[model samples]
Target: MTSQNQTFERLCRTGTSLSVHSTYEIGGEARHLALPHTIEEVSTMLEGATSKGLDPFLFGMGSNTLFPDRPSDDMLFFSLKEHIEFKLLPGRLFVSAGTPMTLLALFGLYTGIPSFDFMFLLPGTLGAGVYMNAKYFSHQISDVLETAYVIDKEHPERGLISVPLSGCEYGYKKSVFMRKPWIVVGADLKLPVDPQLTPEQTDELFAKIKSKNLSTSVLPNYFRHYTNELNAAARAGYELRQELLDVITDRGGKKHFDYPSCGSVFKNNYTIGEPMGKLVDRIGLRGTVRGGAMISDHHGNIIQNRGGATAEDVTDLVKLVQEKVEAEFGFVPEPELVIV
Candidate 1:
């Protein structure tokens, strides 16, 4: 056996529950799973999967993904959530794919940069954010992203390839990464001003942020942890920005973390002159239930795992929404939720 194959085997966990890895807290057992903490480790795992004839399924924190109820035995499920890194560059910030997107807001708070406040309570990791052009109101990752680094899934030995912002073909919840077999490794983000912190201070700040022991995949835990951090910062005399405060109010008002959910389940059909949530509301689909899943009463776009929801339950609701909306509104709303 190749060294990479041996290392991959050593790194993988067998018969693991996928629920713990997802924000929705639903899913059955995965036959094989691995969390790669570095780019090299990711490449090694991919190589190993190829040699073993296993189909590799890659994901981040699984905030936007739904794992199947019965996963294929030959599928290798892996995530990059363990590979968090932050680097302060001369003109920009370098963040690893696995770093939680919400951490960027804390970085902004510590560094006195307001640009990342939109990401304050956003779910998922940086790589997923980049892939979907994750948005909050009018703000998005594409607004701050300068460049992305990726590994071609078909050619892992080619190493990292840099794709400039213009090459990304970013649109409403879309990116070139979605069209290609490219795995996002990291990205260089633009900073409006100098962070004004020494390298040691940056390291210290990041370490402090990461030391909080929060589960990024669990909504309630993730919410409380970051909210407390903001409050702690306020007590330390770091003046809180209104934008940051507004994010808390907006997301909090919507009860985003009150239930286990993958946030918005469908993309807004912009051509319809209204959002998917409002459309679902118009048709009286809000608060609709299917098995253990329910359309969030607070927000029509969300499908929550109220308790013990299965992947099929969520997908059933998704299908119901799509069918009802299509019949009433003359179009099928595309799902934003990734069903694995």
Candidate 2:
């Protein structure tokens, strides 16, 4: 056991506590964490973990996930931070899974493509976005996804097997990746050139996205120059208040992005005239607080970690919202977060 542990540590820098790395700014030490620069290192780590009876968990960007206060020692973590590669061909683009969705979106807009502008303010990497079939109001990642290179950890000898979009049974916030759960190395996306829109329509789409992101207080690329020098104090008062104001302006806003959170804590209503946010707002459960986490008084569907919040605290608060929503409106809400 010691020999294998040593080998795993040698393969990647193993850190003790990683709470600061989380978006929530919570959680305890990771038993082991690896940021492998190359795919070969990733393979070695996975193989070592398996042989040592440790469960391997692939992570990226740490955007859409929340870790436990202290995860099990048996769970080995590795992130593909260094695999972001892109190649532009005539009609398609080959990109590594680690590529930022924002980069792709910006590239699309510059190339006069449609539908990708929605990725302008979206967080997380392209891989996670595809796994979730990321949506932007009306557009979805699956709409342009041609093929993906996925590899089974148990059979790394096959390397990355390319699978077409048809192979992924994609739905609202779901994909076949959830079932088989392989590592996404690269993807091929067909460029948008069909049913081309007029220049006026393209301008309108970009404007619409910019307006939406502004109202939600989600940062846009244009604001990068201004938001770079933020210190500790600037983050709390000015930044947070601006976020709250955005929430106030849009009563049904998705503002988990406003705080350190894994986006929406609960899924929204599918066909109901009013969403889960509207229902929770009706019951006056907004601003509900447990520890450092609170149901945003500005938006109901969001539960924002106000700092120093724990996974247990978030879990308990979820139950609170579920009970209150069911008692008042006779409806139950499912969580979108995958609790570790």
Candidate 3:
């Protein structure tokens, strides 16, 4: 469908649609968008939407999508945010996929490199933290990958495909480019070149790593809904928003975020019995609600859309918080993706 005068010369009707509940602002409208830069213009718009068979829904920095209040037209969204680019070599570095894990955490504190200084408290993108093998305290990013590149649309003119970091089978947010669909376009990683800091000690180690990740400049926390098999309590200070609500109300119950959401809606079933985030906060499903979606009055597995919410009000509030937490703790909980 690339000819509506070539999609009005690459579309953008009044832009602003965003996802993952509109930056936790909450759901809908992305009808048709575009934001490519190269890789032959994203293989000529994915071969002009696979010769009109259309199946293009890529977005590197909507942070982590979820747009669906009523907007699909089948699926056509794009945003590799002008496919960034980076390099370094001799111990590896490459990096692209719209770079910005806070500019690889200030290029790992101006190069003294503490493995991308934990991406200055991650928010998203580095291709959604390597398609979800994302991590922080416990580290992972395949521990400094080593190669990736991708594109593989069954050989779209053999564009890009590197592969390698143990062939990306990483887990928890899995990979192999999220089970093969490819199109990452960068990563090499390795690290270690410091040559002993000094450019005034790498600008005083990137101003003490951006002042220890911006000394909590009053609530900006970023995202990370849990996946901590203990990095000694994220190196002791804990905080990934109170370790995702202390791994979900640590047992009995009690969670309730406010406003902001899209954080967690499912994907915490440590075998269901214990640590399913304290059994879905003892089966209360936290703040619970339906219409303008709720559940987060601070964090019962975060739903929040609050005003004029949609995506069927967060898909009927995740089927009424998984049917009242499977009728009070028998345990069921599911609903990690369904903006439609």
Best by TM-score: 1
Model 3: per-residue Cα lDDT over 1-340, one tens digit each: 4364364346433344655324455546666667766666776777766766657777665544557655666566777655666655577777777654655755553444566656543545577677667765567788888887778764567788788878888876567776787778667888766345446764564444334332111112332221231243456553333433343343114322224454566766655555433555666666667777776654556676667666677777677767766787666765555243
Candidate-wise lDDT, in order: 0.90, 0.66, 0.58
lDDT of 1 by residue, 1-340 (tens): 7788789988899999999999999888998999999999999988888878888888988999999999999999999999888888887999999888888988888888888989988888899999989999779999999999999888898999999999999999999999999999899999998777887888898797677536558899888888998999999999899999999999999999999999999999888998888999999999999999999999999999999999999999999999999899998889999998
lDDT of 1: 0.90
TM-score of each: 0.97, 0.78, 0.33
Candidate 3, residue 271: Cα displacement in angstroms equals 54
lDDT of 2 by residue, 1-340 (tens): 5664565678655555545545555567887788765666666787787777878877666656677887888888766645566665556777777666765654554455655655644566678887788776567889888998887888766677888999988988878888884888778889856325476765564453233221111222213312232222245343323332332233224444556666667777676568777888888888889998988877787777887789888888889989987887677787877677
Q: Candidate 3: what lDDT?
A: 0.58
Q: Which ten residues in a row have the lowest lDDT in candidate 3?
A: 214-223
Which ten-residue region of model 1 has the weakest summed lDDT? 208-217
